[model samples]
Target: MKEHLKHDLEQINHLLDIIKKQGVEYLKLIGARPTSVNHIPLWETQNLPESGYGTEETLKIFNQRFEPIMVGSSGPRYLGFVTGGTTPASVAGDWLTSIYDQNTQSTIGQGDISANIELETIHLILELLGLPDSFLGGFVTGATMSNFTCLGVARQWVGKEQGKDIAKEGISGLIKILTATPHSSSIKSLSLLGLGSNNIVKVKTAEGEREAICIRDLEDQMIKLNGEPFILISSGGTVNTVDFDDFMEIKKLKEQYNFWWHIDAAFGGFAACSETHSHLVKGWEYADSITVDCHKWLNVPYESAVFLIKEQYKILQVETFQNSNAPYLGDPLENFGYLNFLPENSRRLKALPAWFSLMAYGREGYKNIINQNISLANQFGQLLERSNDFKLLAPVRLNTVCFTLKDSEKQDEVGRFLETLNDTGKVFMTPTFYNGHSGIRAAFVNWMTGENDIQLIFETMNEVITQLK
Candidate 1:
């Protein structure tokens, strides 16, 4: 068994060598290919067949099955779904994390691996966003779980004020939710938490372009309610055009209506790093809780999300899971069950990569990366505006650019053309429907992306559009 484990470890090391040497080259060739010869077949086999154990078969499988998918995310033009390319340091840190393989549930179990990294990363994040150090931060799976944790705490606090014990007893009555053009994830979170999506009051936006939750409509709805504790959801970044909702107005409503304010800043929260874009998210400091993903703007690996709670003990009050008398598992000096703060029992030390990246790059490094993307996005928008064959669909805010193809009859046709660009291995971009019209969307969040990449995408887009013409 020891021999076999050592052999497997060597094979993994060999694979990493291949990744280091050929990863970037392979990405340039087929990274954003729509339907290139760069994908592995998916199967549903449950068991493996016994065969002659040899290095040849192992190498073949490694090359054929894993290499394609591995290079998919390392490309310069992968702009679908707000995915971020991993930095070399963070990737190496991930390898170390797997090698150590510690279960970071509590300080006692992991011996400072869990507590120290979490504390350092959270402090760095708070300082980066210019928030108070008193905030409580938890590293969760992704944005969805982050939202679940944040909303869960809000539910507990509001229920407690109304003389109900939500932690002891689950939500039993009808709870109303108010949202300003919620991302589908927020609505799905409400559903998962037993709050029906139908019960949510969708506030109207001012212009059809930006989805700002109308303060007047929200005020009217609150007055009609029968004093039921509500959850008011506001977005820092709209998924379609990256528009920010008026947070100052939303904050006023939070005070007047006395409801919990939850800001879903999954992709756009990191823009606060720049002074120029900071005003876009004004009044975010007043939020009850905020959700930010390190994978997006922070350029870290996947599954690094932070849910910041303004009131630290609120997490302990709402999410205390186990309270047993196991002597071995209990520690009097430190909270042995820090996992109770999140939904998971055995958590990953996911904060290590973020902490390492922040430590390596510092604040100025982060500011430069974010500001570069913002400027490059605007430059891309300008490139589109200069073209007669393309039309700029929405204002370039933060890092997203929305535009449409000219001479297209329907929005679906434009969407089909964009998919063709992806299929041809030229570039990878996604389609989004804005104001009921289909359009192409490009989000620039990868640290490796630069003006050259943006220009290449624009050139490829023009080529695709000309082919359609």
Candidate 2:
């Protein structure tokens, strides 16, 4: 064995101890860490070395080259892009996931029970969201991959309705998809699945600054298809304004239309945990497939989300994603492998962090997190509304506040304001365009965010605005 490899194996416990100390220190000081940095150093890359540096030496090199500029994106004040903070239990599970290094694929014949644990995690997630066990699910990298997986199955199902196996025969003809406002990831997923992203029939949003779909206009668009089957991609919660489509109304339409229903809940699906906000996803269980991100609302680490597709469509999912003609791996249908049901063939035990988080927090814990975040969002929205310098684009319906400068003529200054505000290193928010106006979105998904964070953000925004003015 290589000297460095042998050394690493022998000193694993020491290395782990060092890592744990670093992690604890970072977490403890996360609130004080910068949400954004103005300057980023460009590290010089070295050529491949014939001799390896030991783990300790390599970690030292990484810290020198990279650690300083690593902004606290997972921190409470980092409100950009709907990012989530890691929970202590989730961090523990994520650590074990790397230590175990299990390739989570098969449930029965693989001798590894990671897939069973994954399935149990899915069950816990279902219970947390009040979803039915009829929906079979597995972990993916994030909502983007989850969207890709579910829409891939939707594409195959659409082809079957048209009497063509698109997965096997290749995509042909127009595939109609209807939606009011889908996350950009969903459109990218369509493109990846060979369904043209530009081909979606853009449905009208509900009246008056709402991003939710107009159900009547949606039905009109469906009628224009002349009874042909299509896909209806609805939003459980829109990124801006947290607007949710009427799932109950959509469910009613599902019984009448011959279409595949997909709801991209992503972070917003956690609203099901809040008694007051549960109405947002009233009939989401009726969806053919749903996407939920564990990293966002579940407070797990990155690259974790789940695609829950109805078990009735298992055959279509397998047909869409099957790794056929492999003799050694056994039949895809005979063995319940994740490879035949999602985009990736080999996957990490991504569900462990989620499982650990669910087990640690349980329903009430997550409910508190969800409700608190929602309350914080509202609190932030009220601050924005009360401020003379900012104007809310819409009501804070859930956990994101979409707002812009109060002065309509100063719309061009929005970007500059956001940049300056972020550069303060105290708080961060992302720029957005909504309803034909430039805006900023501060999404509150982090479990650590409290009234103090909101106050700091508000004060920082004011300071930035004053300077910009």
Candidate 3:
């Protein structure tokens, strides 16, 4: 076993050397391939001949089978779902985390390594988002779990005032959630929490507007409610174009209606770092709870997300998973339970990479990187406007640009052209639907992306459009 472990370590070290040498070039080569084909079977079986294979042979088979399934998120042009490429520091830290393989359920179990890293990461992330440090923060799996944790606490807070203990006795009465333009993930969270997504009352907004959820319509919805405690879910950034719902107006409605206000800032929360774009998410500080995914805009590796709440004790109220009579598990002074506030008991040490990234690049460094992405997005938007064949589909609010082809029949044609460009390994862009129309979408969330990358994307787009014409 020891000899096998040593060989595996050597292989990993060799792969790291190859990664450093090839850098972005190798990533571009891999990213230019089709991720999935329609005819490809979703499932395949590998038969074993009654005996287990040796370590090296097993490892080779594992890489051959699973490596192609991985997406090229590290590539500069991967703009599929507002996902960001991981930073160098964060990726290295992720390697270290895998090597250590420490479970971070309790402080005592891991000698406070997990707890201290989480705490430090929370402070750094809060500072980056311009949020108050007094709030309680916990590292969750991703934005979905973060939203679940925040909304769960919100449910508990409002449910307690109505003579019910939701944490112990689950939500019994009809709990209605209200949202102004709900992301699919938010709706999924609501459904998972037993608060049906269909039970949510939608607020109407203006025409040709990316920002849905009118404050007046929301107020009207609240007034009609029959004194049942309601939760108002506001959006910091819309999934379509990074459009921010008027949070200031939403906060006012929260005060008037007395509903728990929760902000879903999964993709755009990091925009708080930039002076120019921070106002887009104004009034975020007034939220009862906020969800941020460090893996998204912060450019950290996947599985690094956080949920922050204004009232620290509210988390403890909803998530104190402790029992008194455990023989070996209960230490009064140092005993920490895993399933406290988060839903999961045995949680991974996902915050290590985030903590390492923050330490390597301080607050100023983070702010600069975020601002650079915003600038790149603006440049891309300008280039789109300059093209006669392309039309801006939405306002480039932060780091996302949505544009469509001028010739309606050539919409899908343009998409195919973009795909061809990707196949040629020049740059990467994706397709998204805006206002019921197909268009190209580009999200600039990679730190390695710059003016040259933006120019390459636009050049490729121009070439593709011309060829289609």
Candidate 1 colliding pairs: 33-425, 34-422, 34-423
Query: Where in model 2 is the C-alpha error above 4 Å?
Result: 326-334
lDDT of 2 at 110: 43
lDDT per residue as tens, model 2, 422-469: 899999899999988999999999989999999988998898888877
Query: Which candidate leads the pack in lDDT?
Result: 2
Span of ten consecutive residues with least summed lDDT in model 3: 324-333
Please identify which of the two predictions, 2 or 3, would achieve the higher TM-score against the true structure: 2
Clashes of each: 3, 0, 1
RMSD of 1: 3.5
User: Residue 397 error for model 1, in Å?
Assistant: 1.5
Which pairs of residues collide in model 2?
none
Score every model by TM-score: 0.89, 0.97, 0.86
Quick one: ranking by TM-score, best first?
Answer: 2, 1, 3
Q: List the RMSD of every prediction in angstroms.
A: 3.5, 1.8, 4.0
